[model samples]
Target: MVIVKDERMSRKRTYLMCPPERFTVAYAINPWMDTSAPVDVELALKQWQLLRETLARLGHTVHVLPAQDGLPDMVYAANGAFTVDGTAFGARFRYPQRTAEAAAHRAFYEEQGTWAYVEPTEINEGEGDFAYLPDAYGGMILAGYGFRTEAVAHSHAQEALGRPAISLQLVDPRFYHLDVALAALDDGNIAYYPGAFSAGSQRILAQLFPDALLADEADALAFGLNLVSDGRNVVLNAEATGLAAKLTAAGYTPVLVELSELKKGGGSVKCCVAELRP
Candidate 1:
C-alpha cells in the first residue's frame, strides 16, 4: 500500500537504516560490451550479486532484474523510480533509447501498487540526475538537468512529487548526471566536485551549504561524490580522501569501498546501489 507522509513531519535525514523488504535491483546489459571494454558478463553478474548481498547484509530485502536487449547501458534504474511522499513515480525518459526502459520500470512499479507514474511529453528521467535531500528546514531537492535530464523534466517531477526542487543546469557534457559530481552526506553536509557544476550553480550550492567539501577532479572521476547513505552513515569510494576527512570531521564515519571495476561503466557507489529508506 502507498502511504503519503508529510515531508515536513518526516524529518527525513541523509543517513538511513536499511529497510528489510526492499533490496532488489535492475541493471541493463552493456551493449558496448566488447573485447576492448571486455564486458565480462560473468563479472557483471557477480558484481550485481555482490551488491545484492552487500545490501542484504545491511538488513535489506534484495531483488535483481535482468537487463533487456536493445536497451543496453540502461542499468541506471534509479532514474526510473521517483520516490516521494511514500509514493514512487515511474518516469518517462527523454531519450528514445530509454523509452522501453521507462515503460518496463513503470509497469514494475505499478505492479507493486505503491507507486504512481508521471507521464509527460518532455523527458523526465529519474534520480540518476536528481536527488532529494530531506533536511531540518524541510525537504530540499536538488535537481541536475544535464545530458540525461532537462529543466522541463524537473518541473514535471516537482509537480508530481508535490515538493519544491531546486533546478540546477549542468553545462558539462562529461558530468551528465548530478550524482557524478555531488553527493549528500549523512551529517547534513554535501560533497561536490565543483568543476562538473556550472559556476552559478556552484555558488548557489555554496550559499545553501557553506560547509560543503570540495572534491577534486581526480576524485570526481573516481566517483568520489557518488556516495550512499544508510540513514545515519555513508559509504564512499576509497579515493575520496578529502571528502572522507571532511565527513569524518563532521561527526559521521565514512565507510570506504573499492569500486574500481564499476568505474569502467561510469558508476560508483551511488550507481551501484539504490537505497530504499522510508
Candidate 2:
C-alpha cells in the first residue's frame, strides 16, 4: 500500500520586504520634553536614522511611513502594528493617548491590497508588548498581557496566526512590553532582563527553553542586554560588557551599537524599531 503525505505541511514560510519609504515614521515631541532636562534633538534624530540603517543592513526592505500631526513618540514605529504572513494586523492601543496610531497603520495596509489582514477588536498594541521567535517547530510569538495587550487579545492573535502563543505577564509598568525586556537569540534561546520577567513567565521560559539566558538587573535597566540577531549574528549595545562576554563564550559574535539618543527617551535600540518580515 502507498501512503500520501500532505504537501501543504512541508512547505516553507515566505518573507516579505517593505521599501525604505515605508520603514519609519516620526512625530516631533518638543513640548513633551522635561524642561528640567536637556533635549538632545540632534542626537535623537541621529540614533533614529541609525535605527533605520540598522534594519536595512539586516537586508530588510525599509519603508519610511508618513507621520501624523500630533503624535510625538510615534517615531518608535513598533507601537503601530504587527505584520506577519504578508498581512498587517492593526492595533488598538490600551492607552487612550496612543489611539491615534491606529489610523496611520490602517492607512498604510489599506493601500497594499490582496493581502490577508486582521483588524483588532480588543486592545492589542503591537511590537511594544509582543515578539515573534523563530524556531524549528514552526515559530512562537509571545504576547504580553498586562500593560497593553490584554489576555483576550493574545488569544485572538494565537487564533489569527494559527500557531502556538506564549502569553507573558508584564507586571512592571517600566516593562510595558515584552520586547522591552526580552530578545530571542538565533538558536531559539532567549536573553532577557531577569527583573523584568515575572516568576511565572520565567518558569514557562525555562520549561520551553532550558538554555535561556537571564541578564543582570543593572544591565537590563540600562537597556544593555537587548539585542537583535540575524539568526546567526547578534548586535547589542556596547555597554553590555558582561552580557557581551557571555554571548561570546557561548559561541555567538556580538556587534555592539551606540544608541545614546534612544536612552534619553526611555528607549533602547530594540524599542526604537521592529525587525519586520525577518
Candidate 3:
C-alpha cells in the first residue's frame, strides 16, 4: 500500500472537553445505550482524564469546560457545536433529553469570547454529525443525518463555516451518530464502517473516497471508527485490533485508549473531543 504524505500533518490542534463529573447512562437514546445497566463513574472519569492527557501529550492544547450538575451527557462535548475558524454553529438536539444541552453549550461558547456562536435555524448535533475533512478534500464538511441531526442543517453549517458540506445518511440504529461510524483523517484518508450507512450514502462515500479504509463488523461494534486524528496519529478505542492494524499499515500511528465505562453512555474518544479550528 502506497502511503500518501500530508505536509500539514504537524498542525497543532485545540480541543474542548468536559470532565465526566456528571457522566452516566441514565437514559437510552441510541442502540448502544442501555439505561438498565449501571455505569462506573470513577472509571469513566479516569478514562476521560487519560484521553485528555493523551491529547496534551500529543502537543495539542486542551481546553476545559465546566461540567454542569444535571447534564449527564455534557461530557460528550463534541455534540456542543460545530466550530470552524472560531465560528460556532450551535447544536439543536433532536431528543428532548438532550434539548437542554443546547442552551448550556451555547452559553459556554458565548462565554468563551473566542468563538462567535451562531444559532442554527434547524436541528443539528454539532460535531457528532459534522466532521471537518482535511485540506486534501478541499476542507469540506462531512455532515451526517438520519438519527440525531437533520439533513437541512447541512446548509446552515456550510454557510456558517464557509465550506462545502457533503451529507451522508446513516442507516444503522447502532451507529446513530456519524462520529461513531466514520473518521476524517489527515492525508485525505477516511476510515469508516460501511454497514452503518444507507445504500445511497454508502454509494456516495464509495464514489467520493474510493480508497477509504473499511472497518470490519467487530471493529465497528467496538466503536473503532469513533476516532480523532491529528493527521499523523489516531486516537480510538483500544479493543479495535483490526482497525488498529489497518491504520498502522496505512502509515498512521494508532493511539489506543480505553473508554469501556464511557461506552455505556454511547460514546468513545471522539465523543468527548470537540475540535476548535482557527
Candidate 4:
C-alpha cells in the first residue's frame, strides 16, 4: 500500500514535562486505571526519565514541570494545557481526582510568565482533547468531546488559538481523549484509530486526511496513538507494533519508548509531553 505524505520541513520543538516522582495508580478514573493493580513507582519514574532523555537526544528541549505530592496523574502533563503560538489554554478535568492538576498547569504557565495563559471557564482537558495540525489547511484544531472534554470548549479553544476547530466525537471510553485515538504525525498528516471515534467523526477524519495512516484495534489498545512526533521522528509506546509499521510506511521514523509503566495512570508518550509552541 502506498502512503501519500505531504511534507516540506521538520523542526525541533520545546516540550514541557513533569517528573513521575509522585506517579502511581492510586485511583481509578479512566478505563485503563485499576486502583487494585500494583504500581511500580520506581519503574514508572524510570520509564518517564527514559522518555525525557529520549526526547532530549532527539534534539528537543525538555522543560521540567515540578511534580507535586497528592497528584499522581500530574505526570500526564499534556492534560494540563494546550500551548500554541505561545498562548496557553489551561484544562479543567472532568474527574475531581484530576482537577487539582489544572491549578498546577496554571501555576507553571503563570510562574514561567512566558506564555499568555488563559484560565478556562469551561471544562476542557487541554491537549487531551485538542490536537493542532499546523500544515493542514493552514493550521486547525481537531477537538474531541464525549467522555472527558466539553464540546463547548472547542469554541473557546478556537478563539484562543486563532484556529478553526473541527469537533470530533469520541465514542469509546478507553479512547477518552483525542490524543488517545488520533495523533497528528506532523503538521500535514495523522494516524488514528477509527473504532475509537463516532461513525460521523470517522467519516470526517477520512475526508480530512484521505492519505492518513490507520491503526488497527490491537495498536490502539497498545496506546499507539498516544504519540509525540517532531515531524520526522515519532515517539510512541514500544508495544504498538502495528502502528510502528504503519508509521514507518508513512515515511516517519518510529522511535519506540518504554512507557508501559506509566500506562497504569492511563497515558503514554503524548500524555507526559506538552509541546510549547512559542
Candidate 5:
C-alpha cells in the first residue's frame, strides 16, 4: 500500500542557493567530475538563473549566497548546511578541497539571521548527506554516511534537530551523497536507487519505506534522484525521462530543467538548492 500521510500543504518555502559565479571543473571530487572536461560558464549561469526562476515561479522564496572567488564548489549549496525548524547544523567537510566552504556557509547563515547555527563536531557534508521525510515519518532525518559524511555525525544531527536520525551507508562511488541516491518525496513516498546503497542500508530503506519508487541505473546516472520536491511539485534534471515518467505516474508535477553544464562538476538541480526551515 502507498504510504499516505496527512498532507500539510505549504505554498511558500525558503531555499538557500549559491550561483555558479566561480563554478568550474578544476579538480575531480566525485566520479562524475573531470578536470579535463570543459565547463561552459555562461551556459551554467543561464541554467542556474532558470532554476531560480523556476523555484520563484512555484511560489517559493529563494535566498542566494554570494559566491566567493576561491570556493567553486560553493555553487552546490546543498552541501552547506542541514536546516530544520530554524536550527542549522553546520557541515564539517571530509576533503580539504572543500574545507573553505564550511566557514562561508556558517557566515551566510549567521548573516541571514533566520537559523540558529549549531557547530558540528564530526565530519558531515550537510544536506548532501541529510534529508527530512514527511510528517508521517515524524519528520525524521535520513542520514547517509560512508563517503562525505561520517557515521558519528548522525548523532550530532539528531541532537541538534531533536529528531530521530536513521543512518544509511552508501556503497557506490557514483552515488556518494544521499541527495544523489535518494529523494524523500513530499507525500511520504521515497524515490531512490537501490544499487547505490549497501546491502544492510538497502534493507533498512525497504523496512522503512516498503512502497518506495525504485530508479534504474540509467535514471540514477542521469542524476534523476537528485531532485527538489515541494510535496507536489518536483524539480529535476531534464534528461531524467524514466524518473520523470515515474513521478508523473505517482501524481506529481515534474518540472524539468537542464543543468548539463553544472553536471560537469557532479551537481544538478537539488545540489544547487538548500531547503530552509523557519
Candidate 6:
C-alpha cells in the first residue's frame, strides 16, 4: 500500500549543476558503470541541459559549476558538498578518480565568498551521503554510511553543520549512497526503499518517519528515490512510474526528466543537481 500525505507546501530552491561535456564511463566504480558500455556524449549533454532548464522554469535558481576536463563524473554536483544556511560541508571522495572533484567543489564555494566552507578531513561524499532537513525539523541530517561515507564522519558533519545527523547503514551495493535509496521529500518527510539499508537502519527509519513513502523494488532500481523535491514538485527519473504515481497520490507534482545517459555513470536527476538551502 502506498502512503499518501496531504497538502505538501511548495518552496523555491537553489540548485547547483554542471554540464556533461567531460562525462564518460572510463572506469567502473558502482554497479551501474561499465567501461565496456558505450556512452553518447551528445545525449548526456542534452539531458543535463533539460534538467537545468526544467528547474529554472519551475522558479528555482540554478547555479552552474563548470565541468573540468578529466573529471567525467564531475557532473554529479550533489556529491561535491552539502550546503545549508550558508555553510558548505565539503566532500572528500572515496575513489582516487573522484578525489580531485572535492577541491573543485571547495574552490567553487570559496569563490562565492558568502559561504563558510569547511575543509573536510573525513572521506564523506557530501550530499550523496548527507541529506539535510532544515531547522524546522531541528535541522536533522539523515547521513548514510557503510559505503561512500564512514560512520565517524557523521560526528564530523554534526560538528561542522551544527545539525543532528542520524546514521543509516547502507547494505545494498547498488544503492551505495543514501540519496540513491532515500530522498528528503520535504523538511518533515522522506521516501525510501528499506532493502537498501541494514535491518537496524530500517528500524531507525521507521521510527523516525512513520508516514514516509516507501518505494517498491522496481521503482527503486529506476533511481526513483534519487530525486529532488521542493516540497511540492518532485523532479525524478522518467522511468520511475510507480514512485511518480505515489508522489501524485500524495499531492506532489512529479516532473519527469530523462537522464539515462547520465545514469551510465550512475546518476539521474538528483545526481545532476545539488540543492542549496539558504
Among the numbered candidates, top lDDT falls to 6
Model 2, global lDDT: 0.63
Model 5 Cα lDDT, one tens digit per residue, 122-170 = 9999999999874747788999998899999999899999989999999
Q: After superposition, how far is residue 200 of candidate 1 from its true place, in Å?
A: 1.3
Greater-TM-score candidate between 2 and 3: 3
Q: What would the TM-scores of all predictions be?
A: 0.79, 0.81, 0.95, 0.96, 0.95, 0.97
Residue-level lDDT tens digits of model 3 in 116-157? 889988999999998887564677888999989999999989
Clashes of 3: 0
Give residue 114's lDDT in candidate 3 (0 to 100). Answer: 82
Error of 3 at 69 (Å): 1.4
Tens digits of per-residue lDDT, candidate 4, 241-272, equal 88899887777888999987898888999999
Candidate 1: give its CA RMSD in angstroms.
7.4
Residue 176's C-alpha lDDT in candidate 5? 89
Model 3 spans > 4 angstroms off: 4-8
* Model 5 CA lDDT for position 168: 94
Which wins on lDDT, candidate 2 or candidate 6?
6
Rate residue 49 of model 5 by lDDT.
98
lDDT of 5 at 173: 95
RMSD of 3: 1.7
CA lDDT, candidate 4, residue 57: 96
In candidate 6, what are the lDDT values of residues 111-190, reduced to their tens digit? Answer: 98899998888899988999987733677999999888989989998998888989999999999899999998988889
**After aligning candidate 6 to the native by TM-score, how far in Å is the CA of 116 from where it should be?**
0.5
> Which is the leading candidate under TM-score?
6
